[model samples]
Target chain A: MDEQTALGLIGDRLAAAGDDCAVVDGQVITTDMLHERTDFPAGTTRYTAGWRAVGASLSDVAAMGATATAAVAVYAAPEFDGTELGAFLDGATAVCDAVGAEYVGGDLDGHDEFTVATTALGETDDPVRRSGAEPGDALCVTGSLGRTAAAIRLFDRGDIEAANELFRFTPRVAAGRALSPYASAMLDSSDGLARSVHQLVGASDCGAALTGPLPIDERVDEVAEDDADRRELGVFFGEDFELVCAIPEAELGPARDVTHCRLHRVGTVTESGVTHDGDPLPDRGYSH
Target chain B: MDEQTALGLIGDRLAAAGDDCAVVDGQVITTDMLHERTDFPAGTTRYTAGWRAVGASLSDVAAMGATATAAVAVYAAPEFDGTELGAFLDGATAVCDAVGAEYVGGDLDGHDEFTVATTALGETDDPVRRSGAEPGDALCVTGSLGRTAAAIRLFDRGDIEAANELFRFTPRVAAGRALSPYASAMLDSSDGLARSVHQLVGASDCGAALTGPLPIDERVDEVAEDDADRRELGVFFGEDFELVCAIPEAELGPARDVTHCRLHRVGTVTESGVTHDGDPLPDRGYSH
Candidate 1:
């Protein structure tokens, strides 16, 4: 089965499954799966892998506007090296500590390749969902984009330290909480801005129009071939782990004042058709 | 690092990391990882794989004496077959239905070999822990043992139907709940009866002595060469998914009355040393 078909099947069977995090009795939960070949580059450290893998699930919790409580991971590898395992746990713990959550221990198993599956738990009385955007809501995003794009370039150039630093972007838990009260709809931009906007509007039965410049990370220019390449990286390449949300225009100022991260109003939710500067935007981004 | 050393490291780092399921507030959560090479034999169907993989985590929730609420799985395969994927989800949903929990949807990815990582969530006011066992407690088990052992033998002889049926054992969630008020310490017998007893004692600073005959499943007689072989299968071979618990002798009768499954008194918690029929039982069973 293709990914879309499989997802459709899942949606058919599980009513509470398609959201970024499933809410049960005011507790939010999400899981992510990452493998060595797909998620980790040749020069990536196990520590970065651990951080990035667990962070993916944490990002989901943030999208729901919940207070992250703890996370657990099932780590599978061909062999267990003391140093590597310690470093991985250190990274996992460090990321959890970064957000004031706990990195609870999980199961271990041996496999032919390294794989990590992580689940994060959080709490909230009211979780923001992807289906709440209004036609006139302002589309906004937290932080600059293209961090992973820049990290991949640095990794390709053998700059492991720089790449690792870029790979460890913070999950937007605080920003999500700050915007929870006013935001009409919310989701993490792990699937790239374009795809995220598409998904947000898709869920809300709305469209979006981008009128402002894309929030490209400054570092992306260092590796980009041209302005178009930089824009592509910013709009299409994902793993930024930023929040993409829609808020009522009247409430955007209050939302901005409360958010800890840089919040930018990039577009407006529309009644029909996604567009960027009068041109239709393609619904494409990182998947699987 | 070896498994023991790694577990010790985890224990040192996270205070809430070593239990069968970590409890946050009143919620209990656990995760498990399984790989094609290590977990699935040649004749194993995707349906059984789905049931067993998710069942493992559900069993952990049961061990904590929690009411399982939901489960999710990350399913990775070299290629997704529509029929196979449907069967897998069907089995997952079926197992959750069996336990009165929801099998919420999970992520999907591609890998060289099939792999699954699952997480189960539950709720309980008074959660049981492996560290609560005490001397003079009665050691008891739910249902019969050696089911997986007999299943493996059947699979070796190409009895795929019977093997799959055996692989789909109950998670013992109800029994765990019934024993919660009385069981001092409880865990599922996935690690084999002998290793489970050793773990129960090790966690609670107690020992055990098996005075009665092992609860060997009658099906074991079909594959065993003699009574000794049947006993070994019941004692050492794992994956039975039955509850092995320590209950105060005074409360054992009440626990037995409430439990829906067949309960049997197998041994007694002692001051020191694990023994069976006046002989020291070796501390060994399934690992990884």
Candidate 2:
């Protein structure tokens, strides 16, 4: 079974499983699994691994427009090196501190490959759902795209420091909280911009038209072969951990004013059929 | 670094990292990691693996005397077998239902081995801790021990069905809640009775003397080589998932009246030194 099929199975049994975070008693909880083979690149440090893995779950809490409270991670590796373990905890702590959350301690175990599973908890009274977008809602995104794409390229080129730095993208917790009151729907763009749009539109039973130019990160120019590659990096490559939200056109100004992060008006929710520049937008992006 | 060293490092950075479950704003949270090689034996069903793994974290919540609210797991395996995945979810859901908690769902990823990391969230206004035991407090235990030890032996003897049944020991969530009002300190005996007693005593700055007969499960007779082996299995082998608590002598009656599980007055807290039946009780048990 694949992730979608697995999710379907889970959803059949659990009514609260499909959302970015499972909200219980006004608390948003989310978990993520990242393995060495699938997540950490060849040159990645344990610290970067720690930050990226924990931040991924924090982003889910952010997606719910919640106030992140604390996070814990289960770290598993074949053996534990004191320096590496300390660095990993340092990174996890740094990320939690950066997002105004606490990094509580977690369990450690032995495994053949290094793996980290993280859970983030947050509190919220009114959570923005993915199913609330209206026909005239303005589609927006926070932060530029293609940071992870550029990071991967830099890693391939042996630029370990820059790659790790790029991997440490900020989770959009503040942006999500700012947009919660005004936005009709919100979700993290960890699954890439195109797929995020598809998910938001599908959940709302609506469509979207991307009329504005994609906010491609400048770093993409350093790695892309051409404009097409740059576009692919921005639109298809994920791990940006940015927020893609749908705000009423009338509320967009206030939402933008409240958010400290860069906010881009990327498109507009439509009555039907997703498109960009008059062309169909395929539902495709990162999986795992 | 070992688990202890890693934990010490984490403790230096995260003040709330050393407790059974991190309590924040009247909520309790915990995470646990289990691997295929170290956790599951040959012939162990995916369902049993799911139950034991998720239940481990739930046990932590119980230790905190919290009402379990919800749980999520991160499942990673080389391939996602539909049958295995379905059975795992079934077991996870069943365990949560048994404890009045929701198995809200989790994430899936591909890894070289079958591994699971679970997180359970709970709530309680007056959370229990390991540092509340005092001199003259009664050291009590809920349920019997040696269940997992016998199960492992039975599994080795090719009794898969019986072994799985034994492995499905109930987490003492209700009992913990009942004792929370009166007990001085409490924690699940996942690390075995000896280690648990030592931990409780160490945390509370006291000692204990176990005078009553060890509540060894009857099934151990079928597997143990002799009385000595039975005693070892009962006291040293862990994974009982029972509760070892310290309660004032005056409150023992009320605690027993409220808890539905079998309650045993195994010992009394002392000013210093740990012993069992006039012999020194070594501080040792399951490590991972």
Candidate 3:
């Protein structure tokens, strides 16, 4: 999707995963547990762009298969620094509204470096677990991968067209929703492909393969001609809000409009664990 | 109102007004907004104690007539350099359970200092809002105050007794719940008694007169008696999670046994504005 769509969808009424609030039914739901839960994804930098920092967390709630409601944004807005607290608020409010959430209430503080803590709560459910896939399931991805990684490089190099096309991502909510009902296991591919495959194997007792070159952007191929370097596509970067679903091969649907993006039948669900050809794998997955 | 009582309530559950996870109906809730919504009583001190820093935000939610559900805590845990994540989690979790909330989920990061953020959510017909007070209502307070300030001074003097009584505080959930039915206005005294009264009056279009001193611990009185200048019951110094509620004088009987702390009849709500003796006013009662 385009930038506006992505921003709008994630900004206002988030169903859930990450962020300050996820809306549920007629009431608002949120939390305040983000201050000290730091044992995972260590070293993730906290940006000083106040609301954007908040958007970062709320987005995580959305990725987790839930709906964010209200939020308590405790941001350290430094004093006398004309750093546009207004812009930060606008961006944050935009993200909240895009996701269909509300800014219920919050507090502010003054500090040396900018630090933001958000607590978001979502509607109730036994959260769709990461360990529910079975053998004989087909491995599928919601959208293309290589694009985001490619965009990172392009953006850094000032390739604005390609960067905008690949970096401007809209969360796969519809696809995630559609596949969620049919898939045995699911995950969000914030980390790259090889790592995600390893995660699925660890949780569901399976391995995946590369039946074809990854769904690379046409722009990427045009630039890296005959390079045969798919490493960038498989295991290099992060920040792709796509879905990885495990479904039975027999129940998989025929070709449809979702074809705008490619979905590859990459591998098999095995009891013996991860393998490509006859060899066992080495890495467990992505580090972050 | 006692030190251990507040600590026992959050017993291992860091649900103090500024802990890691706020306990709500037996669940822990936190979010990124916690970084933005929390405040430190004194200005610019490196947070050396993780539990105390975490308690500030979690307790704020508990005061808002809600409970903790799940939390996403983020921190730079320099304090846990060689310690197991379990002890840290234990301290954070104990506070979560103290308020009847639990830690369901979160994210983690590292840094130079020990910093934490907690986000909590709870339930109600609607929150017992501060904008509900009316003229001629009873100005009531739950629990004691001036102890935290005393505790801070004790921390400076290496006096464990005052420190013990001061830092450990319980959110007035039971009192908030009990008073919810009859409260015309509600607020938590996080800033200070005078500030809290002014806030309640400002929000509700009425004024309040705190005719009597807040109930300070006997040890605090002993310490204050030694320093004539420090004898003010409640003016400056933060971290008191007592509830400041406005209720009709006629309806106090039905609230028996429901309050978790001592309910003090401090004064009355006024139609014109709040005042102390002939003083017109100074601070909005308190400011950072």
Q: lDDT tens digits, residues B71-157, model 3? A: 335544333332334444545555655666554333344433344655555555445566778888888877776766677666657
Cα distance off (Å), candidate 3, residue B40: 8.7
For each candidate, report its DockQ versus the true two-chain complex: 0.74, 0.76, 0.16
Q: State in Å the error of residue B226, model 1.
A: 4.0
Candidate 1: residue pairs that collide: none
lDDT of all the models against the reference?
0.89, 0.90, 0.51
lDDT of 2 at A104: 86
Estimate, for each residue in B27-106, the C-alpha lDDT of model 1 and write its tens digit: 88899988777777778899999899999999999999999999989989887787888889988888898898888878
Question: Which ranges in model 1 have alpha carbons more than 4 Å from their true place?
Answer: none
Q: What is the lDDT of residue B10 in candidate 3?
A: 25
| Chain B TM for prediction 1 | 0.97
Range of the 10 consecutive residues with the lowest summed lDDT in candidate 3 chain A: A39-48
At residue A2, what lDDT does model 3 achieve?
Answer: 29
Worst 10 residues of 2 chain A by lDDT: A3-12
Of candidates 2 and 1, the better by DockQ: 2
Worst 10 residues of 1 chain B by lDDT: B2-11
**lDDT tens digits, residue span A127-159, model 3:** 433456677778777666665556645655766
The TM-score, computed over Cα atoms with residue i paired to residue i, of candidate 2 is 0.97
Model 2 lDDT per residue over B213-261, tens place: 8888999888999999998899999889999999999999999999998
